[model samples]
Every structure is written in structure tokens, then in C-alpha cells.
Target: MRPNREDWAAALAAADKGRVAALADRIRDRAQVDLLAPPREGLMLMQLRESVAGAAFHLGEIPMARVHLRLTAPEGVAEGGAALMSDDLALVTRLAILDAALVADLPEAPEIEALLAEGMAARAETQARRALSLDRTKVDFQLLSEEDE
Candidate 1:
């Protein structure tokens, strides 16, 4: 039998924490005694960014599906792009959930919807930093950092 929306949501939540922990472990291991040579920290940072991106890629579509299955939002897709936590798909998911929560008949929707905007700004910033760290263009973050006046 097919599971319900609640089941989907539950499954998503259950896996999220594990995925995050695993990603962190992978980054730490790669950074510490794993990847030798210079630029170890940057390598680890890239790995961590990848981990985050991968998680969002997998779990990002979930929140949108939850909205769709519940028929909370008007039947429509959303916009997306190469954003941090807000991958195009992830952004769509967030928008779907936000729209649904805003108009849904459920009482708990408000609280759940609040998370749509939460961390989005932070995610973008984090992703930008990660991308910069991985830049092979020789961008000097130290110089950039010092120039901020």
C-alpha cells in the first residue's frame, strides 16, 4: 500500500539527521588526518559543501511533494536555481510548502511554514563561501577579508 503524506514527511525527517551527521563525519575525516598535503582545509570545506548540496538534492523535493499530496497549494510548480540550501528544486519545495501552509486548512501549518524562510539567507551565504573556497581561480580570501573596510 502507498504511504500517506504524513508518512512521507516522517520518513524525510527521520533521514535528515542521519544524512547530516554522516556528511559532517565525512568532512571531518577528510580534513583532519585524511587528505594530506596543502589546502586540506579547503578540500574538507569543498567536501562538506558537496555533502550539503547532496542532502538538499535528495531531500529538497520532499517538502514540495508533501504540499502536493496534501493539495494544500494550488497545483503549480516553483522557481529554482543553483542556490545554497535553496537549490532550484529545494526552493520550489519551500515555496510549495509556504504557499500551502499560508492557505492550508490545517492549524499547524503556520509553524511549519515558518521554516520556509528560516536559514534561506544563511544558506545562500554559506553556499557562496563554500563555492569561493573551492574556487580554482586563485581568489585570495585572505586578501578579500583584509580589504573589507
Candidate 2:
């Protein structure tokens, strides 16, 4: 199944860094990229809510990077932006370029989609492993009346 655009940034961020860099470089070589604003790196507050009270509170600060840029290829021009909870500005910038390239339907869009698929698969595998580990530790509690029966 095709991934939704809303999931692109997270999938791209989790993709192989070397492949991402190579693809972004190739796109840059063929397209004109203009940064809408200087790439940014800073901390963002992490928020969480209590399940019972449904009250929100600051979890902590996380390092983040964001990029906004426009890509102009022969096919068309497109804009993309990425904000990720990571300190790597270059990676975030590359992800933004890839996002715009996909939006513009550049020749490299297929490769970008492949990378996204690989990333999503890897993420799913990791989640499955974690779930198995949790399941191993699961405890079943039985009430005294049920146990007596």
C-alpha cells in the first residue's frame, strides 16, 4: 500500500542515511533548490498528557531541526518542509529536498518511494520485536473466586 503524505517525513527520517544522502545529492544536481529560510536547529518542548486526569504537562525538551525549501525541476516546482526531533540539520535538509522532489514528481521519485517503503518496513519490524518482548513479560491476573472455580 502507498504511504500517506503525512507519514513521509517520519519514514524518510528513519530511512538509510547513506541512501538518503545519495538520492538527495542526485536530485540537487538535477534540480534548482532554493531554501525558503535558513535551516533551523533548536530545542522543542515535549508535551504529554496524563491518562486519568487528561491533563497535559511538559515531558522535556528535545533537539529538533527544520527545513523549508522549494525545488524547481523541468517538470514543475514544488515546496516541501520537514521538522524532526533530531539534531541533524543536514539530514533534515536532505529529507526536505526528497519530499519536494517527490511532490514535484522528479525522475527520482520512485527511488524515494522505495526508500520510504524500506524505512516503514524496518520500523514495523522493530515495533514487532518490541511487542514480542513485552508479550513475553505479560502477566495474567486471576481473581480469587475464578481461581477457586
**Could you tell me every candidate's TM-score relative to the true structure?**
0.26, 0.88
Task: Find the candidate with the highest lDDT and give its number.
Answer: 2
Looking at model 1, which ten-residue stretch has the lowest summed lDDT?
35-44
> lDDT per residue, candidate 2, 63-99, as tens digits?
9999999999998899988888889999999999999
Query: In model 2, how large is the Cα lDDT of residue 10?
Result: 85
The clash tally of candidate 2 reads: 0
Q: How far is candidate 1 from the true structure (C-alpha RMSD, Å)?
A: 18.6
Per-prediction tally of clashes: 2, 0
- Write down the lDDT of every candidate, Cα atoms only: 0.33, 0.91
What local lDDT does model 2 show for residue 100? Answer: 95
RMSD of each: 18.6, 2.4
Report the lDDT tens digits of candidate 1 across residue range 11-124: 223233343334323322332222111211111112222455454222222212212322222332222111122223433333333333333433434343333233343445
The runs of at least 3 residues in candidate 2 whose Cα sits more than 4 Å from the true structure, single-residue gaps closed, are 137-149
